[model samples]
Structures are given as C-alpha cells and as structure tokens.
Target: MTNPMRFNARIFDESFLDQCDERISAFYLMWKAKCKEGRIPARSDFDPLDMVKFLPGITLVDVERDTLELTYRLVGTNEVAVRGNDPTGKKVKDTFLANNWEDVWGNYSHVIKNKGVAFDDSDMPNSNGVMVGDETIFVPLSQDGEFVNMVMLYSIQRKAAG
Candidate 1:
C-alpha cells in the first residue's frame, strides 16, 4: 500500500474561496461567528482523529500574545498520533530546532498584518531532518479585524512508502 499524505492544499486557493459552495461557506461563517463570540478555545474543538479522517493533511495553529503553537495529527497505515507544541511560548525565540520559525513567523506576521490569508508551497523538514514537500495555508482570525489573534494553518506532505 502507498502511504501518501493528502493535505488541504486547495483550501488556500483564492478561487477556491470564491467558489466555496454553500456547505464550506457556511462552515467558515460559523467559525467566524464563533470567533466573534470569543467562543473558540486556544485548543481545537475538533477531534484530532477527525482531522486524520476527513482532512488528513490539515494542521491547526494558535497565535497567542507572542507565540505560535501547533496542533497536529500524524496519520499512518498502522498508527496515529496527535501532538501539540508551542514553538515560541516563553521567549521570542523558537523552541523546536526542526522548524524554521524565522520564515514561518515572517509569513504568519504578514498574514496577521494584512488580516488576510496566505499560501505557500515549500519543503518542510520533519523530525528526521529530511525535507518533505508541503503545501501550507494561513488564515488570520481577528475580533475587530485589526489585531490578529489566531491563525489557522493546514498543510500536507507527500512521502514515499517504505
């Protein structure tokens, strides 16, 4: 069997947003309303396992006062794992050596500043230090459309089967 990670690459497309059917738009609108109500928690409400079930390549990120945290699930043929980490929780520096926070922070900062969505295709290095092809999308969420409070991210990586 081939183990391929099918991430949510298309979610970042502007045209896709424009063409978002009623179902998707309704979902986004519901999320937006939740953000407005300040009901969304820093932690995800959706089950990590559901991410693997429906959106195998999707990842979520939370933007706190001065940090970016990641909540993700790994789906493989045999096992699954859900992990959460705050790459820059205490200091202004990144905690994880495997992540390039410089680039990621800059990109996320841009999205926050613009109060919009950002998309990019790049090679991400995993824990093993091997570069994996990935597609990422960042969406800024705000209460007043001025300060970005949260940024949602979805990514997918393609890997070869052993």
Candidate 2:
C-alpha cells in the first residue's frame, strides 16, 4: 500500500532504520507509508484491516486538544508484553511519576506543537538498571483538517525472554 510518488521523511532518528532491530524498522516504515500525503494523518485515516499485519505492535494515542493530554486509546499486544499490562484509556502523563514524566514529554510534545513527527530511543528511561531496551516513534495526527489532535505511538522493546 505504499505510493512511490510520495516523499518519505520517516522519523525515529531517521537513521534508526539502519541501527534498530528489524521489527522496529518495519514498524516505522509502515507508519510512514500510512501517513496522509506525507503529513500527519488523522486517527480515522488508519484502519485496522489495512494495518492488520502490524497490529501486534501498533498503539494509537488520542490527543485531547483542550488539555494537550495523550490518552492510550489502543495498546497492542506486543506493547503490552513489554509494558507488562494494558494501558488503554490511561493518560500518558499519569503513567509516569511526576519526576519522570519529563522523560517522555519531549517525544509527544514536539510532535503536537510542531505538527511533525518525533523520534526517540531515549524517551523513557530505565533507571532501575534493568536489561530492557525500547525505541519509540511519535507521529502526529490531525483533526478538523487544521490541527494535530492525535498521535500514533509505535514502540518496540526487548522482551526479557525473546
């Protein structure tokens, strides 16, 4: 479902495609392919049917325009495995402690404010010194055809066993 005529300004460090694991790179590519005219795509633009193959690792976040808050509307199975639970319906900010919330603020805030994509491998920190690693891509989604109002957060993390 890719269009050869469209430009690809794929995010996630841009070089992440070369450095990250295969799954992460594929997720990033799929996201970029699904965007609307190389611009941020609205939530409605994404249909699970077309995204079925990638559904296992895709998570959709709805942006509350009034508060600029992010809510986890859909948390993928693989993501749940990494996070150890489903986070749907929870505010992204509420998931982190006050002291650590800033750790991930930039990833989402940048996309929301700039109407662009944000890429990061260090959005959330593993301060406990665990042997876990994760990569995150925050893509803005527009509403009313004028402003960004949603975010598609595709994150891939190492599973303790796999």
Candidate 3:
C-alpha cells in the first residue's frame, strides 16, 4: 500500500504556484498597503475576514521552523459553523480528522515548499453526510521569493441549481 503522505502529496500540482503569481502578488500588495496605512502591524496582523473581501474562500496558515499551522475563519452559507473550529491560531492537523487532515496539510505543505500557489477541487463530506464541493487556492507568502512562511486562501464552491 502506498503511504498516506505520498497519496496526499499528489493532490497538489507542481506548477500550481506559477499560475497564481499575479493573484499572490496582489495579495502582497494589499498586505503592504495595509501596513503602510497602519492597518497592519506585523504578519500576525492579517485577518482571514480581510481576505474574504477579495476571495470568499480565503484561509491562512502560519509556518514556523518546526510546525505548519492553519488560521482560517469559516464563511459562506455552505460552511457549517462548527463549534471550536476557529481558524485563527489553530493548525489544520489539529482541526480535522486523520483522513481529512492529511489532504489539507499536504496542500499547505506543497505551496510552502514550492513557494508558489496551488489549486484544487474536491468533494467533502460534511457532518450531516452531505457532500460539498470545495475549491481552494493555496498561495505562498514570501517577501523576496526566497523564504516561504505561510499560505493564504481556502475557497469553497457552491453548487448551481440545475
């Protein structure tokens, strides 16, 4: 059997980062503008809600030297407001179950390592056993395109009426 980690690694595209360079650049510009306007103090000054203004399905992750962490806020009508699943200051591994967690972390790791953006779509099973299609974009955060630290954005897709 293949290792679960290996399986998770395949979900991300190698060139996904290259495709999102412009969007990620815009994000950085926004961050810089916020900082100049005194809306931000440090990297921690970012709020997931701020991202929703541009991307509804935005999520954030903080990467330290030893650990990968996810910071997000559940938004949109499709997302069930689960108790105690606050995205801010929480790791994705700690927030999700083993099966789901691996896939989520894998994408985050991919973006960080590639120092680029990644995109994916999947059908997720919810607490009520309902299947929801989720579309996400993972963007790497770096000042000079050298040191990668965090990922931002996790957008979900809504089904259209037939």
Candidate 4:
C-alpha cells in the first residue's frame, strides 16, 4: 500500500493563479471547480466544444489500466510549440518526452493509482543544453468512479528556450 499522505494536494492557489494570462488561468479555475468531493472529473464530464477559448493549452491523455501506460489522445494547438510536434494517438514512451519518460511516467502513474491530482514545475534541459520550463497540473479522470482511465492537463507556461 502507498503512503496515505502522498495523495493529498495543496489548496488551489487563487492569488498566484491570477498571474497567468486570462484565458489559461480561467480555464484552470473552471476545471478545478468541476472537481467534486475531491474526485477528479471524468472525460465525459467535459465538453471540448464548450471550452473553445481554453482549448489551445489543453491535452487529453488516456490511461491503460492493466499496463499503467499513458497514451496521448489529443494535443492542443499551443502545446505544439512546447512539444515540438503533435503526439496524438501516440504513447508517452514513444515521443520526445522519452528523454525524461521515467519522470513523466512516475508522475502519471501516481495520479492514476491514487485517483488524485499531481502537479510539477520543472525546467527540463535537453542534450543541447536548451531548457524548457513548465508548470503542469494533471487531473485524473475516472469514468467508473474508481479507475483512472484518462487525464486532462493544463500545462501552464511550457515555454521553450527559457
């Protein structure tokens, strides 16, 4: 069994959140409000068409239960510049993210297994010494109210060459 304290997260930082550009910050606020009983909302709970204004930085990730692998379902427009390419319909192990795939997988696995949220802020450096700074929040989605089958991300400030 995992440590119980590991699943708890900090409160929604409303004050610091305002630092984000209006659209992206607003999107996070909305998504966070949808979370009830501290339970993450399922994919069906959201309608992409309704979030047009915030779609640019959004991405959907599918979780393979038995294997605990993550799959990219959608890669939004703004995410392209940060990702260097679209990764839709691809597995996390087969992409540029592979450079730090273990970190990526561990973070995702934590969220899926605990049915909780996970956030990270890191500056990733590549072989060329170029760094990509990012702050991301991963929201788990459980269609059956127990198993996390998917996840949604609002990757804030994933700027290239920071």
**Top model number, lDDT:** 4
Q: Report the lDDT tens digits of candidate 4 across residue range 4-108.
A: 111212223344353444554666677777788877777888887888876877888888879977789998786776656788998877873423566667677
Error of 4 at 92 (Å): 0.6
Model 1 gets an lDDT of: 0.45
In candidate 2, the residue pairs with backbone N, CA or C atoms under 3 Å apart (3 or more residues apart, or in different chains) clash, namely none
- lDDT for each of the candidates? 0.45, 0.64, 0.49, 0.66
lDDT at 52, model 4: 80
Q: Rank the candidates by TM-score, best first.
A: 2, 4, 3, 1
Per-residue lDDT of candidate 1, residues 122-162 (tens digit):
44445454545555555665544556666655544545222
lDDT of 2 by residue, 49-85 (tens): 9777668777878878788888889888977765567
The TM-score obtained by model 4 is 0.72
- RMSD, every candidate, angstroms: 8.1, 9.0, 7.4, 7.2
Candidate 2's C-alpha runs over 4 A off are: 1-13, 36-38, 97-99, 122-130, 159-162
Q: Which one is best on TM-score?
A: 2
Off by over 4 Å in 3: 1-52, 68-84, 160-162
lDDT (10s digit) by residue, model 3, range 1-162? 111111212335434444333554455456545444322233455675676555443555666745545554333333323222344555566665225665667777777776545666554444444444444566566543455566665554444112
What's the C-alpha lDDT at position 96 in model 4? 35
What's the C-alpha lDDT at position 161 in model 1?
A: 22
Better of 1 and 4 by lDDT: 4
True lDDT of residue 50, candidate 4? 83
Stretches of candidate 1 off by over 4 Å are: 1-59, 64-92, 96-100, 144-146, 159-162
Worst 10 residues of 1 by lDDT: 74-83
What is the RMSD of candidate 4? 7.2
